[model samples]
Target: MTSVGTPPAAPVTAEAPMRRLDRRMIWVDAIQMVISLIPTVVALAVFKVEPRPQVIWPAALVAVLGVVTAVNDLFRWLKTRYRVTPDRVEVRTGLLVRSNLSVPRDRIRSVESTANLKQRLAGLRVVTIGTGRHASAGEATIELNAVRRETAEELRRLLLRGADRPDDATVLAELRWRWLLYNLVNIWAFLTAMFVIWSAYWLLNNFGVELDTWVLGLADWEALGPGVTIAVATAAVGLIGVAGLVIGFVTEFWEFRLTRVRTAAGTALRTTNGLLRTREVNRDDNRLRGVHIGEPLFWRWMGAADTAVISTGLAKAGMGAEPASTILPRGPIAEALRVARLVLGGDDRPFEAPLRPHPRRALRRRVIWALNTTGALTVLLLWLDLTVEALPGGLWLAGPGVAPVAVLAAVVAYRALGHTVHGRYLVTRSGLLTRSTDALDRSAVIGWKFRQSLLQRRLNLVTVIATTAAGYGRYKAPDLDLHDGVEFADRATPDMLTPFITRIPPRR
Candidate 1:
């Protein structure tokens, strides 16, 4: 990844010419055509139909549908036009109903541009404008394809208000090849999980019946033999590994030239490998829930770091998604340092180095996790009445179990670093690799919730979660001075949400 320079200094502007997607719609329209071909081949080739009326009718119907959709798409494209003025974005489109939509600069959440397989090959990109606000109670989104690069950027500038906001801090990070190293670790983790699950099948058949379970239909009971089972499982697991490898290959191939140009519209991750897809994202500093950058000894040695967002939508159960966000292209520690700076909203000293958790909290979390995990394991043991063989051939789960304990330790070190407030600004931190945190102005929280479990109520441990368009985040503070965890609901709620308190339609 090459460090991106500042966005073009001049006011960015552009016009998009309406061009229909290629005749691919023909294939789409010919759903029946494809269905017919299967039967046609069967009847004509195998059955040797004389007139083949069965095949001809479906084929003819498909042909008609294909011709109609293709023609309709042409007119559809002609009627669609995206125009960007310095202040507003006007999207004019209509086929039968006809519609004209405009978003003020402030209304737009993010403007995205990229090329799909077709558009990329044609040297075109797709531009999507997401109006953070909803339309008639629902979120609004728009997508346009096959637009020129300059044109796309021009529109981005208009909606974002300018090509660049001189007042806003600028971050220019280059894409580095070494980033692949992080991905390799990920590949190893995934494959290891697959292999472990497969290897345990022979050993855990009885345990499944006795020990553990999830909500409903998340796990299976039937187990397999390790050797043949592993072979079959390997076929499946190997294919997935191969697929992840393929995506890795593609990311390297496509995003090899990745460069992020941060401008007023958002960030454009430019690539040269010609993947035909470029991801454009606009994030409000206010929406930041957390910024996490990790240089695990493993990754550090490989000269890579994984950074990610810890916004509102962290996760429900178990380890959540990648807070190990960016599989940052590799570079000197300075680059990793700079990336962390960006995540912390360009804070001059945003703890570029890993911050340890509070020792007390770390130990506490570990005790809790260990107790629960071991209790679960115990229950599973008793429930299954397992032989020594059931625990794992030779302690497969031990290594991973220790990892969580380490997290509890990290928590203890980081507890003191918990959510700190500077007036209305809030910042919080948690995690090692998939770690995350959320930092937002108190006023940016659209909504919040305080939840307590039956056990939590007695212990004074409660969880507070805040929600906004950026996503959701939660704070789990336990062992309050009182029987009730020192919950901040009554205070934090109104303080954080006073600004954007509006009715949001249910997620569609």
Candidate 2:
């Protein structure tokens, strides 16, 4: 991993373990059998269709292929080993495709691991080594199926560095429970949405009468009362919400677990207690990077928060393009912030002064957005109105309704574009109710850029963006910042506070 802040160097070596991962992973495949239906009982009574002799042999051949693959995986798992030297980590794998994977110690970005439900029961694990690139997805870097809990940590420690820093230890063991509940909230939302959907289906089935396809196509808004439109909209939103929850529940269920990890490294938080696969990442490169905390109104009320670190890494097979950002989600600010601080050792400055965005700027942004929304509404409303004129309206049935609502949305978005940067830390957020802020160290910034279009430049308004790789995200002083509030935008501002602060080159 090359650090722009730190000088680049030859790829550091890591002592490759002879076999960091156990070969008993066949156990994981055993679990999959339940899902594959290899037994092929074939609901004979229900289908009343017996297998034809002509196709039986082919089906049997396919089943044999699956069993053969599973067997091959078992043998490979049993033979694979990983060993790490002071300079490089080596992985030996494959029964047929013979290959040796060697990654340097310093080249490792971060280490992550996971265990599926069956793997968890068997004490098996998967590891991912993030090369900080898109090409290193194969082999998962290292995978140990059914290894002991302590062994995984020991290997993790050696792979990251050589020393396990107590002060930097960051192990998350409760993601499964937390993620499960989070998915539960989504499921409830889905169920709630179903009521609205089923209601819509009812309306369409029972009330969509005397429909002429041509009339439906030509329908314009000048014909209907506003009450019916509102009801339909409300129903539509409710149904969508329910659909979201169902998807959340199903998606969250995939290979979920709290991970365990301990690595010899810069920041400690990279070590997670449990994950289905092994992963390595670069913490030092992104040490100064920051994250934005966005807790929805509902989650906030429940005293929970979702934290995400922004980075530029591409996604892997299971590695999210922004895995670091999404996986770093911490809880209640107190706990989350503590974890963040531990992981980001250099970032501890508190909020001293607040930099707020200009109200007029936000308002202008809102007005422009409102006009566009109004235009969309005009079209929708016009079409609905024409359709409604032929049917007896249900409820909340007007022309003013659409314009007022569209304009209101624009106003709200404009009003929502506000930010507050405190002391050396900046929290710039702009969203309706779900605003987000990029929190990071000011002194560590590599450089700052202000960008705006001609219209914005003429308005004397531009976005102030500061960046750092250690930082998870880039902070933006949009619309307004310290300039309006008597603050200076220069590298000197940081050096004045921290003498150790040096000039960081422009981001690549």
Candidate 3:
């Protein structure tokens, strides 16, 4: 990757002394390993097992593994040494085979400092430096596992070349207590609650505890009546789910604040949040290509939305990973828009730009797809009912009921399709359950892709894709009129598509 900005003054040379990670990390790793072994110890006690070969063997194996892990961590801590020079940040580590890695300082796109409960207690933080490049194997970022909190903070500012307290820094957003209400309406909250419950049950069952049987014994289902019992059970689950959401929201977003600060290179967006696991991320403004405003169905109904940046090299590393791109949690839609404008450093043109709706053929295409899927599913259910005698006859009623819902979904999806060029941004909106409006920087678009399936070709529709290095790397405007889509892409990034675009004279 090419470097950006000028080299720092008073640059540290390669001869500068390399610094070792905090020694406390070894003790922290040891404590964590011991904590992990607690489950095996508990399992032995709960089962009231004799120290036979089978029981003793597993416990001994776990102890051995824990000891090996501790030893490895200790060796790793002793071997790892990192240093920052004028042009690059470098690290060297390993016992048997030494590994050295270096990244240009100017290529650094983000610097994040995080500390979990254990690390916080030890006055330590984990610092991760992102360059916004994807590695074919392993992580594309550099990490310092455990460092003094003060050292981590100084490193963040040093690597980003950002001011500690810029007078012109502006607070874009902050945590609002009322925003917690949005968490209860999220589907993920209920799913998380159920997952926790199942995990607990599975753990207890593995330890030879009949948790299910004990829970069943606590209830008299027959006397209470099926409907009443179900209602009570649902209420209990709902309460638990809500409680989980509340606690999670509080812990993850406590004292949340988003600030835009001046840096030596340019400006950067900084986010600080968390209660138990504090995190602070600094994203260079130059790398930020756009803003994504997501409105999940439930959150939309509640007038809430979440905001994330469409930035180069800020993509999530894996499933369920939180990236530094996220700027705001679920909050009022107005607040989301306001932050979007602020981040974009302009007026509301990008957010309020009148989007050109996709052709009506798009609507027809969606309806046909929805009906075909619904028909196929209904036929499968009927086949099972008549031939296999598996599903109940009354279950077939779901097929007829689902038809209307599918049509509604198709209509909603059709309404969501829109694209337009707003000033320096190419704005596109799509999706039904979670509609997203992305206002991507026009200059960031590297290329354009036009796709047409058989059905779309027959309908004279095309999917215009704007390819960029940011976010998902591609944003599409689906089911647009062939000519309109071509023109849209051409206008979004002037001259990029003109060379390949063939203009056909209009027929009289």
Task: Provide the overall lDDT of each model, using Cα atoms, as 2-decimal numbers.
Answer: 0.48, 0.51, 0.83
- lDDT over C-alpha atoms for residue 487 of model 3: 89
Number of the predicted model whose TM-score against the real structure is largest? 3
Candidate 2's residue-wise lDDT over 1-508, tens digit each? 4543322232334333265455456756765654444334342234443655433544466467768867877777766766666656677777777778776655565565655666666676555555444445354344445466566666565555655555444354244445444433443564567665565553332222222443346545346657766676566565688566545444443343222234333343442332333333434334434555665645655556565554444233353333544544335655555544544444443322243546475466556656666666656666776677864443223334556665676675555454555555555565555555556655556666666655454455656666654433356656653244223345324444243223422222
* Candidate 3's TM-score: 0.89
lDDT of 3 at 457: 82
Q: Write the per-residue lDDT of candidate 1 for residues 372-443, one digit (tens) a residue.
A: 666576555554544565555435345446656655654543443344443444444554443344445455
- Each model's total of backbone clashes: 35, 87, 1
- The segments of candidate 2 whose C-alpha lies over 4 angstroms from its true place after superposition are 1-21, 27-83, 91-101, 134-151, 163-184, 187-267, 270-288, 297-304, 309-322, 325-355, 376-412, 415-423, 470-473, 481-488, 491-508
lDDT-superior candidate, 1 or 2: 2
Which stretches of model 3 miss by more than 4 angstroms? 32-68, 95-98, 135-137, 195-219, 317-320, 382-400, 503-508
